[model samples]
Target: MSLNSVLPTRPIQRLSEALANQIAAGEVVERPVSVVKELLENALDSGATEILIAVEEGGEKSIQVTDNGKGIAADQMLLAVSRHATSKITCYQELSAVASLGFRGEALASISSVSRFELISRQDVSANAWRIKSDSGERWSALEPVAGKLGTRVKVDDLFFNTPARKKFLRAPRTEFNHIDELVRRAMLSRMEVAIQLVHNHKTVRQVEAAVTREAQIKRLGRLLGDDFVTQSMHVEFEAQDVKLEGWLALPTFNRSQNDMQYIFVNGRIVRDRLLFHALKQAYADVLYNGRHPAYVLFLSLPFEKVDVNVHPAKYEVRFADSRFVYDFIRRSVRDVVARPITQADAMRESPASVFERPDQHRQGKSVSTSFLAPHKPSPRESQAFFAFQQPVELPLSDVPSINEPLLQAYADGSDTRLASTSNAIPPLGFAKMQLHGVYILAENEQGLVLVDMHAAHERIVYERMKTQWQNQRLIAQPLLVPISLTLDLADMRAWETHQAWLEKLGFELEALGPQQLKVSAVPTLLAKADIAQLIKDVLADWRQHQDSERIESQINARLSTMACHGAVRAHRQLSLAEMNQLLRDMEQTPASSQCNHGRPTWVGLSMKQLDSLFMRGQ
Candidate 1:
C-alpha cells in the first residue's frame, strides 16, 4: 500500500506535433504584425529594390506584400510553405555569423498554418511563374502558370482562420494597424537604400523612394517625423573598429511626452536594445528632464557575429557580445557631436529665423537703451531701519510645520542656518514699496536683488507643494461617479501590473476589467481634470518604450517631470501685483529656488551698477 501510494498515478506525455507547432506559432507569428515583419524582412533579404505593402481593414481581412526581388523557381513554390525552408542561410556554422535580417525560416510555415496563404513568383530569366495556396495543409492546390514580372507577391487572408482562440486575442483594427505601421517604419529606417511603399485600403499611407545618400535619408525621416524635428535636429557621426554610429539627434529643447521618437538600428537591422537606450539616457542626462524623451535616429553598424539577433522571435531585440563597449561608444560619440558648436549653416537649418537673414543685418538698427536715474538718498532713520531688517531672525521649527524634517533638523543643529534664518527674518519696512526695472525688488542689505522669473518662480512653488503632498501619500483623490474603462496594449498591461502599488500611491485606483482593459475609479488630486483614460494609455506607452532598461528610476523621473509640467504655471499669463508678491514670498521659503526642476536658472539678478552701465550713466 505504501509503495503504491508513493508511485505516480500516470506518466507524462509530450504534446501533439500540431499543438506544439501552434504554441511555437503563438511565439513567432502572434498577429498580423508578426506576419508583416517577417514578410518585409524576406523582401529586404531578397535584395528587393522596391517593396510595397497593402492591407485591408488593419490586415484582418488580408495582407499583401509585393517586392521586386529575384523570385523563386516553380519547384520551390511548395517548399517555401514548408518549415525550415529558407534561401538566406544553410549550415549551423553560419548561425554565428548570420548576415541577413531573417534566417530562422519558420515564418512562412507558421503563418500558413493559421491563415489562407498564397505565394506567386517568377524569376527574372524565367518566362513562366507559379502559384501555390495552402490552408493549414487541409486544402492545397497549384494554380495555372501565370505571366508575371521578375518578383514575388504574397497574400495572407483570413489570418487565424484555423485558431479561433488566437483570433479572439486580436485587438481592434486601428490598434493592429498602428502596430503594423510601426513595424514598417522600423524596417524602413534600417534599410535606406531600398524603396518602400505602404498602402491601406487602396490609399497610399507611406512611401519612400531610394534616397541618394545618408543625409537624404535623414531628411526623409524628418519629413515623416515632422518638419520641426528636422529643423531642431543635430547631425551625429562616429566610427570605431569595425563599428560606426551615425544619425541625427534633436536638440535638447525638442522633447516628447513619450520616447517614441528614438530609433536604434544595429548591423542594418532595426532593434530595440536596452543598452543602447540606456546609453542615450546617459548621454543626455545633464540636458533633459525626467519623462521628456529626446528625438533621434541612431544607426549602428558592427560585425554580424558581435550581435545575437535570435534572442526574440520578433527579431526586434538583440544581445551584444560587448554591450558595455557599445554603450560607451555610442554615449561618447553622441556627446561629442552634441557638444560641438552649431555652425552658421547648421543654425539656419535648425531655426527658421536664422534662415534668409544675417545676424549683423538683424542687429543693425537696434541701438542699446541707456538711461538711468540716481538712487534717491534716504533719511538716517530709514537707513537704520533697513540695516535692522537685514539681521537674521531665529525661527522656531515648531512654528513652521510645512518645513521638511531634514531642513528643520539642519536649522536646529546650527549647521548652515544662514539661508534659513534670513528666510524667516522680517521684510524691510519699505520692501513692498521698492521696485527696480519695474519688476525686481531692491532689498536693503541682501547681496542680490530679489529677482524672480515669473513663470519659473510659480512653477517651483506649485511643484514643491504638490510633490510634498504626492510623496506623503496624502493625495486628495476625487472619485468618479461613473468609472472609466481603458483599453491598453499587452506591454502597458504588464507595466500596470508591475507598478500597481506605485500607481495606487499616486492616487490612482484601478482594477482589471478584461484581458487588456482597466477600470479606473479615481485619479490623483492634482490631475482631477486629466483624462484618466488617455493618461493611463500614455503612462503605459511610456513604460513599454523604456521598459527594457534596468533603471526604473529613470521611468519614475520621467513620470515626475510629466506631473510637474502638467501642474506648473505656464508662460505669458499676466499676474497681479499681489500674486507676484506672494510668489516671491514662497520662493524665499523654497530650497533650490534659484533653478527649476530641469536645472535652468529660475532668476537672474542685475545690480544697480550694471543697470547704470547699460544706460550710459557710468560715464
Candidate 2:
C-alpha cells in the first residue's frame, strides 16, 4: 500500500480571519431581523433617547438605523467593527454580570462581515464625525472625518451578497419585513422610554414616542398590541425580596389562539424563556379556555447576578440561580390578578352613588365603592363554612332581606306604589325582580339592568371556594367509611409511594395493600362525593405525565372544577328572589367568579344608556 492509502482524506488547517467571521455570522446573523436586533441593542446601550430604522426590499437591498445616542469616539472607531472588542465590558467579572443589552461585541463584527457596511459617528458636540467602511469580512477602510451631529448611524447594503448560499435562504420581501417588524415590537416593549420609528419601502409603518407617563405607556401598549388588548387587560404588580413584576394581563375571556401576544422582559432585556412561559401558562390554567393563550406584557426585575443571560447566542434565554422560587413567584402573582373578583365599580361605568348603601345614603352623597358582599368582610372560616354547608350564615344587611326571606315578598305588597317606594333601597345586584324562564335572574342596580346566569354563577362560586381552602392548606379531608382498594402497575405504585407527602398535602391518603395494590382511605372533604377510585387513577395518570415538572396541583384543580360543575345548582331550577340575591353576594367575594369553569362570563351588566339604546329611547 502507498502512503496515500494509510493517510487521512484531508489535512487539518486553520481557518482565515474572514472565513472564521462568516462562519460565526451564521449563528449571529440569520436574516434581516438578526441585524435589526443587534443594531437596536447597540443603540439602546448607547443611551439613545430615540432611534430610526429604514429598510428597502426587506433589508436585502439596504438597511439603515440612526440613533440620537452618544456616538463612538474616532480613536475606537476601527476597533468597533473588530470581533471580541466591546465598550460595554472590560473584565471577566463584568461579563459574568452583564447589564447592558449588547455586551459580547460580536454583533457589529458579524454584521459588517457579510454586507457592505458603513458606520458614522460623532461623540458629544464634536466638530466632525468619523466614518468607517467595510465591503468584505477581512478588510476595513481607514477612519475618515465626516460632517455629522452627536449620534450614530449604521448602513448595510446587499446582505449576504458575498455568500450566495445564505442569500438563497432569504424569503419574500413581505415575509422578511414581518420578522423585522416583530423584532422592533419586542424592542419597543422592552424600552418604553425610548422613541422608535420603523420605515419600510419609504413608508412609516410603526412609530412610538417615549412613554414617560402611565397613560402614554398604555397608549403605546394599545398601539402595539391593539386597543382591544388594553381595554380588556388588568394592571398587575408584585414585589417580593429581590424580584419585581409589573405588567398587563388580559382577562381570561379575552384569550387568543396563539401565544404571539405574550411578551416577557427581564431587566429590560426581552426573552422567550420556557420557564417564564410555563409559569404564566400554569397561572392561567383552567381560567382560560382550553388551547387558548392569555395576552400580557410582563417585566421582571431582579439582581443581575441572580440570572445568567449568557446561555444563548441571541440572548433570548436565561438561567435563574433560584428557578423554582422565581417560577412560584410569577405563578402566584399572575394567578392573583387574573382571579380578582368583580366589583360594583367594574359593573357600573359611571354611577354616582353606591346601590348597596342604606336607602337614605343612596339618595344623597357621593357613591361609595362597594361590591355585592357589601357589609360583610370575607373571613377564611367563612370560606370553610361555605364548603361544609352545615351552617346557614346570614348576610349582615339590615335593609336587605335575609337568606330565608324572599326579596319578592319584601318588595311586593300587591301595589305599584309600594314597589316604587322601595326602589331607593336597591343593592349592587339590586333586588332580584324574578327568575326569567328559570335560567336567568333579572335584577336592577342604580346604574342599569343587571343579569345573572343562575347556574354558571353558582358553579364558579363553588369552584373558587373549594380551591381557596386547598391553596391555603386548609383543605378538609374525610376518612372513608370503607376504603376503596385499587390494583396498580409498578410505575403507578412507585408514583403513589414517592408522592405520598404531596398527595397528603392535597388532602389524600393512600396506603399500599399489596405490591400492585393500593388503598384510597381518604380524599378532600369537598370532593368526597367524587368517584374516589377514578379520581385517584386520573391523579396518578397526571402524576406520570407531569412527573418531570410536578405541577400536580394544577391537574388536581382540573378535576375539582369538573366536580364543582356537577355539584352546582342546575339551570332551570326555580329559586326564590332571595336565593338569586344570595348567589350574587357570594360572587363578589369569590375569586375569578366573573367567569365560570368553562371560561364563560357568569353575568352581564347593562348601563342605562345601553339599555335605552336597545329600544331607541335616546336615538
Candidate 3:
C-alpha cells in the first residue's frame, strides 16, 4: 500500500520502435483474416485491378498477395514497411474525411513485426522491382532491385512465429481459412470492378472476373451467392441526403440459419456496424421469420466527412455523424423494395422465359413486361382473415366444402401450354394443381413449379394481417387482478421515465411506486400470457441499451407469432380448391408473405432447368 513504491516502480521511458510496432501488431494483426483484410484494402487502395491471394495452411505457413496496382518506388519501399508510414492521408484535418480503406498505415508495420514479411514492387515507370524484407520486429533490409511486373507482391511467412502467445490463439487451419475466405469475399463485394482470385494449398478456390456492367455484376453475385440467392433477391438502389445505397437483398423467402451472408460496406470499406445491422434487422422484421437472418450485399456511399472511420484500431467499426438518419435511410430503402409485391420481372429472373411464356412472344411486338402482376388493393375481408379464423367454425371442411369444384373446373378447362402462353393473365402463384400429404401445396406458375407449405404460408399471412390490424387498432389494455411491484436501477428508472408514454401506448399501465420502483396494474391484451415481469425487465433493458427505438415491437411480434401459429390452419386438414386459391391470392397481396413470422420460407420455386437436370434431360 506504499504510494511511493507503486509510483516509482517504473520510470517514464519510451518504448523501442520494435516494441511499439509489436504492440500495434497485437491490435491490427489479429489473425490470418485480419492480415488478409488489411492487405486486400491496401491493394485496392493502390489501384489494383486484379488481386491474387495465395495461402498455405490457412495463412500460417505463408500468405502471398500479388496485385496489379501502382507499385512503390525503391525509396518508398522502406517507408511502406515502416510504422505509421502512409501515402493515404496527411495532417489531422485528413482524419475527418478519410477515403482510403487502410489509412491507419499500421498494418504492414504491425504484420511485419509478427511474421517474416517481404514486399516487392515495380512502378509502371520503373525499370525493375525493388524488394524489402523484415523479420521479428526488426528493421526492413535495404531495397534491392529484382525482376518483377509493374505492380506489387507481398509475401508473409511464419505468421506469429515471433510471438508464441499470439500463435497459441490461432484456430485450426480450416477454420482460419474460412475466416480468410469470408474476408476475401467481403473485399470482393466491396469492389466489384476488381477481379479477385484465392488459392489455398495450390488449389484454386475462388476466382471472380472483373465486373463493369450490370449483367456482369449480377453474374458475379450469382457466382458468389449461388443462383438461388440471385434468383430470390431483389435489386435495391436508393439515395437520400447525398447518401446512396445500392445492393441486392434476398427476398424474405431466401434467408439463412446464420448471419454469415450479410455484408454491408460503407464508402467502399466493409464494416460490421451495429447501426447498420440494426437497421437491416428492423427492415426485415415483419418479413423475415423469427431467428432467421436475411442475406444481402449492400453498399452505402456518402461524403467521407459524414462518417468517422478512424474510431477503431482495426477500422471495422464506424461512427456516423448522423446515425439516426443513416439508419432510417437504410431501413426505408430495404422496406420500400421488400414490401413491393413480386412482379413478372421477378418471375422471369427466377426461371427461363421459355418455361413461363410462349416463344412467339419474343418474336411478336408484344412484350412480357405488360404481363406482370399489377399492384392490387387488398380486400378488407382478406386483411381481416386472421380475426375471422379466431372465431368458432369448422377448421377447414366447414368453411368452403364445395368451393373447389368450380375452381378446379376453370383450371382444368385450360391446357398447360395455353396456361403457359398466357402467363401475363395468370396469377403469380399460378394455379394450384393439388395438395401433397396435407402439407405442401403443388402449384404451377409462370416459373416452372412452386411448392408452398400450406400451414406455414397461411401462418405468415395470418400473422401479417393480425399485425396490421393490431397496429391500426392499437393495443387494448387488460387489467391485472392483482398489481405487481418491481424495483429498478437508476438507469432503468431513467429509461422507464423517458419511454413512459411509449409504454402506455403499448398498453402497459404502470405508475411510480417510489423513485426506483413501480406497480404494474395492466398489460397489453395480446401479451397477457407473456411473463409480465420478465417482459418489463427485457423492455427496460432494451430501452437502456438502444435508446430512441421501440424494442417492444420485437417482443410483441414474438408473442403474436405464437398466437398465429396456433390459430393457423393445421396440416392434414383438406382445403377446397377455392380456399387454396384464396390463400394464394392473399399471399400475393400480403407483404412478406413469402416467409412465415418465424422466418421459414413459405414457398420455393423450382425452375424447369432444375427439373430437367434432375431427370437428366437430353442426356
Candidate 4:
C-alpha cells in the first residue's frame, strides 16, 4: 500500500477503439454548447445557407441540427463517422492553408462515441436518401433507405450517456442553454447571408433572416447589437495591399462598460486574437473614455497563408505571420476613420429630421426642414461667409488675427440669420457661442448643440502637436559637459551594441568603454529632466524582452504627455469668446482630438431630436 510500490513498469499498449474515442470526446464535446459549436461549423463548411437547431431539456435529452447544404452519399455514410476521415485536406501541406471552419473529422466520431447519434443525408447525385445510427459495438448501423432533403441532419440523444462521468459534470439546464445561445449569436454574426432558426422545448426561441443587401445587413446587425448601437455607429471600409477590413465602429460617445460587445472575425472565422485586440485597444486609446471599451463588429480578410488558424483545436485563436505589420495596419486604419469630424449628414443618418417635421408642410407643398433649430439655419454660404466666405482655409497659430477683432466684426457686420446660414461652412465643430463656467464651451453646429471640455481638448491638441513636431524634427542631442560612464552586465552590453545606431537616433550618444562599461555623454533635449540612467536601463530591459524599440518611444511619449498636460489651459480660468472659438477650430483640425491624453472624451453632441424627446415635443 506504500506509494513507492504503486509505480508501474508495464509496457505501453494501444487503447481500445471505444476507450480511445471516449477520450477524444473529452476534447471535442465538453458540454451541450460544444456539441452545438462543432455541428454548426460542420454545417457552415458544407455550404449551408439555412440552419435549424432544436434542443430539449437544455440538450440533456436531445440536440439536433439540420442544414440545407451538400450532403454525403450512401457509400460514405459509415466512413463519415470514422475518425480521421475528412474532405477538407488530403496531405500535410494542406494544413498551412486551411480554409474550412471544421476539418479535424474527429468531431463526428468523438461525439458519436459518447451519445446515441443518428445521421441522415441525401446527396444531389444520389436518387435516394440514406440513414445510419451508432451501435454499442463502436460500429455504425446499416445504411438503410430514408426520406430526407438534399442536405444533412444530425441528432444526438442523451449526451454523455455512454460516459456517465461526463454526465455527472453537467451544469444546470439554464446555465447550459445560455452558453448555447451565445454560440448561436456568434454564428449569426459570423455569416449574415445565412438564415438561422433555434427552437427549445417545442417553442421557437430565435429566428434570423438572411441578409442580402447593405440595409438588410445593418438591420441584422441591429438585431444582434441593438438599434442604438447601429444608430450610433459608422460604417468603415479600409483596404491595403492584400488585406481588407470592413465593419461598423461605434462612435467614441457610444462606449460600453465591458468588452462584451466586441466581435472580430478573421477571413469569416470568428477568432479572439491578441494582436488584433491590442491594435483595437491602441486605436481607441486616445478617443474613448477611460475604463470603457469600444463596440464593434469588424471583419479582417487576408491571404490564407498569412494567418494560421490551426493553432488551437477549437480554432478560436489565430497567429499572424507578420504580427507587427497586421497590428500597425489595423491601428492606423481605425484611428484614421474614427477621428474624422462628425457632420450634419452623419446626424441625419442616425436620426432623420423628417420624423420631427410637421406633416402640414408636405400637404402645403413646402420643403421639409432638416435643421434642428427653429426656422432652420441656412448653410454657412447663405450667411455672409463667417470669414471671407470663399473656400476652406487653414488659420496658422502664428498668423491668427486677434480674437477681439473677429468676434466684434462677425457680430457687428453679420446678422444672426447670416451667422446661422454660414454654420454649414464653419467647420464641423461649428462656432463657439460662449464659455461655460470657464471649463466648457457651448457651440452650435448644423446638427444641434456641442459641448466641449476646454482643458481636455486643448491638452490633446498640444500633445498631438508635440508628437508631430518630434516626428518631423530630429531629436536635439544635449551633450553632457562631463561624460557619465556607467557599468552594464553582459546582456545589457550586447543589447547596447546591437541597437547603438537606434539609440543615437533617439538622442543618446552612447559609447562602449569595455564589455561591462558604457559611457552616456548625450541625451534628448525633451528628456533632459528625466533620470537618464534609470531610463536607459529600462529601455535596455524592454528591448531585450520584446526585441523592439517601441518601448522607448512609448516612454518618451508618456513624458511628453505629462508636459502637454501642464502646458494646456487650466479649468476655472476664463477665456474670451475669440479664444474659445480658436480652441474649437484647433480641436477640429487636430487628429485624435476627441479625447485627451488619458482617454477621456473631450466633447459630446446632443441632437435636436434628443432634446425634443426630453420634453415630449411630438406628444
- The lDDT of each candidate is 0.65, 0.77, 0.78, 0.75
TM-score of predicted structure 4: 0.82
Q: Estimate each model's TM-score.
A: 0.59, 0.80, 0.84, 0.82
Q: Which segments of candidate 3 are over 4 A away from where they belong?
A: 1-8, 286-291, 346-420, 432-443, 447-453, 548-551, 565-577, 604-619
lDDT of 2 by residue, 35-90 (tens): 99999899999999999999999999989999989999999988898888998999
Q: Poorest 10 consecutive residues of model 2 by lDDT?
A: 366-375
Which runs of model 1 end up more than 4 angstroms from their true locations? 1-20, 342-619
lDDT of 1: 0.65
Question: Using TM-score as the measure, what is the rank order of every candidate, best first?
Answer: 3, 4, 2, 1
Top-lDDT candidate index = 3
For model 2, what is the alpha-carbon lDDT of residue 359?
35
Candidate 3 local lDDT, 247-312, one digit each (tens) = 888766456667878999999998999889988988877665445677899999999999999888
Q: What's every prediction's RMSD, in angstroms?
A: 17.2, 8.2, 7.2, 9.0
Which ten residues in a row are the worst by lDDT in model 3?
A: 365-374
lDDT of 2 at 85: 90
